[model samples]
Target chain A: MKEKLYRAGDIFSRSVGLILFFILWEAAPRLGWVRSTYLAPPSRVFGALWLLALRGELARHALISLRRVMLGLLVSVAVGVVLGLFIGYFRRIDRILDLLFQAFRQMSAFALFPVFILLFGLGELSKTIIIFWASLWPVLLNTSSGVKNVDPVLIRSAKSMGASKAFIFINIIIPAAAPEIFTGIRLGGSYCVMAVVAAEMIGASSGLGYLVLYSEETFNVPEMYGGIVGLAILGIGLNWILHRAEKYFTSWKEV
Target chain B: MAKIQARGVNREFQIRNTLGRKERLKVLEGFDLDINEGEFLSLLGPSGCGKSTFLSILAGLDKYDGGDILVDGRQLQERSFSRGIVFQSYALLPWRTVIKNLEVGLEIRHIPKHERRRTARQYLELVGLAAFENQYPHQLSGGMKQRIAIARVLAYQPDLLLMDEPFAALDAQTRENLQIELLRIWETDKKTIVFVTHSIDEAILMSDRVAFMSARPGHIKEIIEIDLPRPRTEDIRNSAEFAKIRKNLWGMLQDEVLKVQSYGGYL
Candidate 1:
């Protein structure tokens, strides 16, 4: 079998491809290949972002959006991990909840906005709920699976050494599941940002998402593009930090 | 004296049918064996012959229904720290460094941190892998990983090491080299090693005795004691005596292999 042409997360350095993409992005609007009205020039979008930052609008909106994302992430991770570990460790509980949870997990979390708004009301609670709901499943599901699929041989090996069940759970099971658990948390972090932004765009009075939607409604194309660029930056920044955390925590695992 | 004994051990697997009926798959039926202390014994057989199942039962990692297994004349009921296992897949925790892995048993024993490190260092040097102490399992090749696995089992200070095809995944050259390393280690420690392997040459080269087994309600066919001289090296592979034993095992093992072929048709 032929090997894959490229590996995921191996695109960080020596990137001829990403450079070409940026160059094309800059050239398209300037060359009139793409209309500036439909697709604002990168320079203008950046300038707009810079002006907003200078005027403090970007900082205010970005901070508001970031706060929501962090709160949602914190809540979801705490609850989701506890729930996931319970579901994963208890076979009976896993069997009962896996099907129902998977069904809810199957439905797009954003589609629950109406239900969230109805239950929690159109406030910060509802916005946070959207993100919390979006981020919960990945952590919960990944953790459960991670716990369930730990190599039986490893467990057996540990058991043969006379390791207690509690010792095995802490040392063997947690370390074994760390890689997958981090994967869930990282995905949840991304979902938190995405869900919050979407929620803000729909109803929040202020935030990066609202800025983008408000700019678009007011026909401020550069500001709209700048807000989106802000989102991309936020997403990239969150991923990069999570990458560092994964490195620190899973130093024992293969790169 | 017998170091380990299994008297009419039986293990069965219950499988659920489509009609919700349970069927019993007898893996080992009335199997019996005796292993002496400080001797290298190889459980030689084809795949799924319950050799590993028996080894696991002996190691107290699995339960058997119909027999009494005595370890050092004590009835075996649960995993004892005195018995260690080395798996074919190496089974080293990928998250742990070589030294950390070697220290696992000591950790379970609740040995002081400094003491465990000193012991881990000794065993790491014993396996000639001291330079790779900080390396994780993923960083090591199959041969290196298996060496680390041996080092860990040694560090655990188990008198009886249950090795399940410890070198089966390595290349032939690495396998041969590890076999030599194992002999050298065994010479120094003289721990009783129960090795499981499907390879006839591996069995003859490493064992003081080979207990051949047959599948489909697996049981030991016969125990053949290898009368080959000690500190046996690869040069023995060229000798007439080595050839004779290999031929003997191959001839007996061929029938079992053929049984597997008529039923399963693959190695």
Candidate 2:
């Protein structure tokens, strides 16, 4: 009963903090302490959001952003896992590709945007490629590191039990490296969304980033605020969803 | 036929310092030993004694510069599906639940999924972890993780079991409990076991014969037989007979242990 009360008290305090934050935000605008032109009030942003929702523009933009993020992330995951397994398991391959991987990873995805644009044009291809590039390194590096860090004792144990190389890879290496790989996937997902937004902002016809830029240029301050709010919500939502998935996958792990 | 025989086993490791000075570290030097089928032998020595190196050679995970290991009348070059090892770390796959971890060896052998599940369940029950089959290794205590490891090896039905200080990482209480559990498993499995440990008490408790080794190019110094009765309980540690044998083994190891420490090595 004491434990129950403590937990309830903890949760209640957190809820109070959230309520206080909103109260402060609401007061700042009501008192006109901040310029309304530069920082549109949260109330005004919500009103613009409601208008976008009624016109269905919000859904359309969110769907476009979601599709791009998923496509780029899926490709990154596939290529990263395969390449990582190869580099992680084989000493020769790891040695051969180590420098190349390191150099490529050091180069930022944003810096390579121009190169991608030249290759794939300013269509969805270039935008998707930027996301793919940003997402790939984390997934690949994490997977390889995970595979490399598998316990030598486990390898010895598997060999003693007469498991073949293929068997050990499937049975031991993959499962042992799973937690790290999932961590890589989460990092990659975040990068994928961030990169897609940047790609859309730089050169794209439709996306939340493009919508934000278009509203800012047209001097639709409320619409711009609405776009920024939407992007923030999307990023938080994606992160939360992936975190839930990670939690589900690693449920067997002790907290 | 002898369960295992190592004739003139020599293992060498090459090391290069930062100055590019290359040197040879001979871990095992012309080591030789033999074990009968169904024997429980403990290789007892201090750390850096190469007892584990020797065991690794016997398990066919490491290649010797010379000599060969024969298991059941067949000379082997590398590990086959005939031996199973329990490492000191327990080495349970953290991502898998206890049952899934136990099923790894079976899964590797391409046993049907349902059969693997049944076999894993049986071994999990044997280890007294049937209720916690779905629990991950991180959720378990040290002793429980080691038990899952033992079950995983047993699931493979290997004729020869190689244990490299399997309980050395646990606390004293947990170690003693695991030693008792190990003996029980050995009795039920009826497979030949070659266990490596530094504890004289542990060597005497679990083995049919204790092979004491001297460190620094490790060599077997003596083999003492334990004529104690089966199904050993914790009370054995307090028994007169057990004390007598423990003293005898400790006497033989005293000089070696001193020799090991004087040479700047650990137990």
Best by TM-score: 2
Interface RMSD of 2: 1.7
Task: Quantify all predictions' global Cα lDDT against the true fold.
Answer: 0.89, 0.85
Chain B TM-score list for all models: 0.95, 0.94
The TM-scores, chain A only, for the candidates as listed are 0.90, 0.91
Enumerate residue pairs that collide in model 1. Answer: none
Q: Name model 1 segments beyond 4 Å from true.
A: A1-44, A217-221, A252-255, B16-22, B260-267
Least accurate stretch of 10 residues (summed lDDT) in model 2 chain A? A34-43
Q: Summarize candidate 1's per-residue lDDT along B106-168 as a digit string, tens digits.
A: 999999999999999999998889999988888889999999988888887988899988899
Q: Residue by residue across B95-176, what tens digits does model 2's lDDT show?
A: 7888999888897788999999999999999989999998878888999999999999899898888899999899999988
- A3-23, model 2: which lDDT tens digit per residue? 999999999998998778767
Give each model a TM-score: 0.89, 0.91
Model 2: pairs clashing at backbone N, Cα or C within 3 Å: A162-B81
lDDT of 1 by residue, A71-170 (tens): 9989998998889888898999999999899987777768999899999999999998899999999999999999999998999989988898998999
